[model samples]
Target chain A: MAALILAHHQTSPAERLKDAAAVAFIALLLGIPMIGLLTVDQGGALRIATRWPALFAFVAACFVGRLVLRYALDQWRARQLARDQADTPAKEVSLATNPLLNWIGWVALGVSVALPIVFAENRYVVDTATTVLIYVMLGWGLNVVVGLAGLLDLGYVAFYAVGAYTYGLLSTQFGWGFWSALPVAGAITASFGVLLGWPTLRLRGDYLAIVTLGFGEIIRIILVNWTELSGGPNGIASIPRPSFFGLPFKPPGDDPTFASFFGLEYATHQRIVFLYYLILVLALLTNLFVSRMRRLPIGRAWEAMREDEIACKAMGINARNVKLSAFAIGAMLGGFAGVFFAARQGFISPESFTFSESAIILAIVVLGGMGSQLGVVLASLVLVLLPELGRDFAEYRMLLFGAAMILIMIWKPGGILSHREPTLRYFANGGRR
Target chain B: MTAPAPLLSVEHLTMRFGGLLAIDDLSLDVAARKITGVIGPNGAGKTTFFNCLTGFYKPTIGSVRLNHPQRGVLRLEALASHQVARSAQVVRTFQNIRLFPQMTVLENLIVAQHNALQHASRFSLAGLLGLPAYRRAEAAAMAKAVGWLERLKLIEKADTPAGALPYGMQRRIEIARALCVDPLLLCLDEPAAGLNPRESAELNELLKHLSRDEGIAILLIEHDMSVVMNVSDHLCVLNYGRKIAEGTPAQIQKDPNVIKAYLGEEDADEMRADELRADEAIDQEAVR
Candidate 1:
């Protein structure tokens, strides 16, 4: 029996060598145009220069990497085979019980709350941190659809757009405050989520992704073309900022703003600080709702649906309702974050809600790990901060970002925090208590 | 002879897939709290019939009627797949064993009680707010799941992922998961497929206990003679999409059609010819 298991895992040495050769050959083929060829301009004419040294180095690296990886894999297989023969239990990592990982999420949360205070003098850092929090909120929202429900939503930003535009139009037209328009924006965006979900509920995986992608495009296009209501391409402007309850976060004007009411001198950083805390609370609420929902029966059913839809159906789980709830709830949270986006910026455009935004949000969720709430927080920080850190490499920022994402996938295909904790446990054993 | 009213009545069921006639015009009645064994050759449409009866497949033509205690009589084929399990209380296990693999064995059982808990949770609002009532209901569900795990001899593996367990344990876990549905009629497709002799023996005892003590009607599909012959109260045999024999185990053993079906027509004829060799010789002499 042990031999049968080993036979399945171990590859012949010849196959490994062949694979290494293929990697080297492909590297050479692609390297010719990429690393080897460089475009140079001379008197308005472009000429290609052969960078043979760089090309050879790239090919040599690919060859060496493949050989080393294949050897390591072979050694691991051998070790696993020996363990199987010994009938020893394999190791499993669970963040719920792991000594180091157990409190990492709480630690990250604490640091995030104190970040603005640490960099109180730097507006740029606080603003970037606010952007990161917005993404953290969106990642949690999209995690419902992609992580729990196993519904690949490539167009999640449409809901974000709906919330932003809802606030943008409503505050400018009906003059609703941020607190008043927030729920309305969420409800409308959720309705839009259902509108998209109802017809496409039957679709799954890539097909579902395509339909959602189209939905996002349709929303953006309509917002851009519908001149009368959406203000066409220019978008709504001067959306009112959120107030401190009723007191405005502005200079001491005729109406006696927040600074005057408290008998404090107005500082430009105060509004930024207030906005940062505002999103912090919202993002925390989003995380709370997702984590709480994950422990519920409906939440378990969502994860179960992701694992096996047919089994869920056989168990009397109403898959249609479960999936629709995931879509609506995820979209609703995205909507809340969008409302905050419009209020903070006081301006909006279709450009803010593009396919790239959806992709980035999805990347954060996947990079965090499907169905892992803390993973989203960690992933949002990496995805948002990485590009900021790469600011010096301006033109190569995206390239570096892509390379980092690929490296992460190679290291952990299931995401950085892929360990799943049981929603219910009968014994306080290896599983989560 | 008049018989007791069946807990389930499947009538004139026919399922076709494009050009293939998977199931012919078949009909059967499963009695209350009795184990009915369905045995058939490969591709004889045993699982197809179960799927049709359990509402997994909408039969090309037929009605599957279930006599539910609280919900009254329901046409199962008219309902969706989940409705068959939910309202009609007809639960089934797959031939290949489809447990929620990543879930703990205990979680798998609790998920089976999703509808009941959902109702108690007030559509999740109470659960979301962490109300005491929802928590009580959840604890009750957990207790029930633990009870099943204990009874199934799986309490030790309760926290283990269902997929990580041995094959026999996984099969039992699937059955335990089905039981959590409060099924009025339990359908098992090849429950003994992957089990060793000892596991099969334990399964027989479990099935008998469930049918006798719990009074849950069971429809078992099996090719294993030892299991089917010993446990089944009523046995039905099918060949080429038609019922060849159905009776008590003793009667089915002596059933001529069943014998011919199992041993091809030519082999049976050859065996009878050898037995009548002397008699045929005497008849030839009389003719002379």
Candidate 2:
């Protein structure tokens, strides 16, 4: 959906038509294979070809179509601007102040939150929404470091893994509850954050990124190799699910479970509703924390360091301390999300916390505007939910996903929303009572 | 006023970049509440001296002391740039304007006051939970930023990006940022390099007020002779990485070495002839 929006905003009628035609032609070419994949038996060569061919063909066509459309549009906009009267100054279209748009955006956000509760009958949709919320939390956490602090952290998932394992090991071994273990997990991950920051604080840009990537991989490797502690590839299972103050999410009898206590029927939809609300609270907490930090002195220091390290140093800001704090805080948020993930899934595996997971989180941050809380949430929702929604278009899903990201980036290099340039503003009346 | 101890005292400062001696045995004192101009021909180690004083470059040999009566003495030589700025109350502007380009004009001032901002709210978990104190501090910082912008006549362009301003306006913005730090000593490296006549005059007035009214000491490096002579309370001239002369502006102007360095004998004679013709033209204009 974001990709289609970007395509419409960025391309002219003629170029869009050309792209549409190319997509249609490729669809026709791959129609037979797609049909075979849907209808054929498992063990046939046709099935094998059908499984991969349409994906490959769709990817190739989208790649070619995007390049051609971009080139054509660039030429057209250049010509149109040039042909306009030279004496007339180009009109500056400012998007800074639009109260109506801002109100609408807030309203839309409220509706998105209330939708899951309203439509609790659909299990798949609720699950998808839950997944989107998790990504939103991850994106917000990464945004604090990457966007606000201007630190590129390729190893952010290491903290997430640490959080998961911390909760998983503590709760299972000690028979501790989820809420009790969550803080412990977060604190442990934050300690690792400071440890990671200790050596790498002085590094900047690409060097910092490389070091973080190594850190992420090291955490994953430790999980994989430490069989005694982590249970190796067999991952921890039967992890305890979160209950509302010791009430299990089952139907009540003489043993009062969550559903019976709440006077609800035994429906999976009730559990989904509970989880959705839990994740929503967590995501909101993450956003609230990051937004408040940004308004604080430490947050301002982080932004100052991002803008110019030398100037920051010259202004008496301890760059090392500022960076470490940013890392620790961002990691703490990641840890919180990780604890939530572990509790929500009742199972843990090294496969869940891979380098690819880190990449996807980072991609969400980039696709959203860096340093923008709202943009991160929106980007994560679109990126994570779209792939699930497009599952029926399975063979072409990832291809279209990649193409969409490229198109969005081309249209808005600063991300989908770039209006939030850092600033200091004063109220007209001094010191409001 | 009794001659107070130098606000900033440099003793035997020396810096070397490998084999090249950028600054050699350079020593100078910046008096309190006075403008001291460091003037020199090209490659006279003027900028290097500033760098060493500000802790940007650690000198191979030197002790730089800031004698603040209230704050006690500080050894600037061993501290990092940020530490020097905070403890010694010494702030500096770059030879080239280093305003945070993507930031707003107001944000640039607020960033300069970053350390001074209250962190009590930020330190507590309540801040992370969006306490009212954090919002109050932000509003205060913004208000202070606007005040500084208005003083520098940049209030109209307060919301515009810093990098989008014209060159002269940017230079003024840099000065405004430095002032926002409320430093005891301000080091300006060629602040008049790119200013037009009107802008230069405005800068001259600002510098005078900074010294006279604000009681802030200024250490200036300027290539423009008019600005240096017009504004400086005392002048220190450097040649070949050494102080050739130090005196009042009038005394330094008459010094033979200063004359010889700035103008060769042939050039001096030609300038003398031009001066005579300028005097005659002025007299004729006065008569008419």
TM-score of chain A of each: 0.87, 0.81
Residue pairs in candidate 2 whose N, alpha carbon or C atoms collide under 3 angstroms: none
Predicted model 2 interface RMSD: 2.5
* Two-chain DockQ for each candidate model: 0.54, 0.47
State the displacement of the C-alpha of residue B265, model 2, in Å, after optimal TM-score superposition. 8.9
Write down the lDDT that model 2 would get: 0.81
**Residue B64 error, candidate 1, Å:** 1.4
Q: Provide fnat values for all models in the order shown.
A: 0.71, 0.59
TM-score (all chains, Cα) for each model: 0.91, 0.85
Alpha-carbon runs more than 4 Å astray in model 1: A1-96, A429-433, B270-288
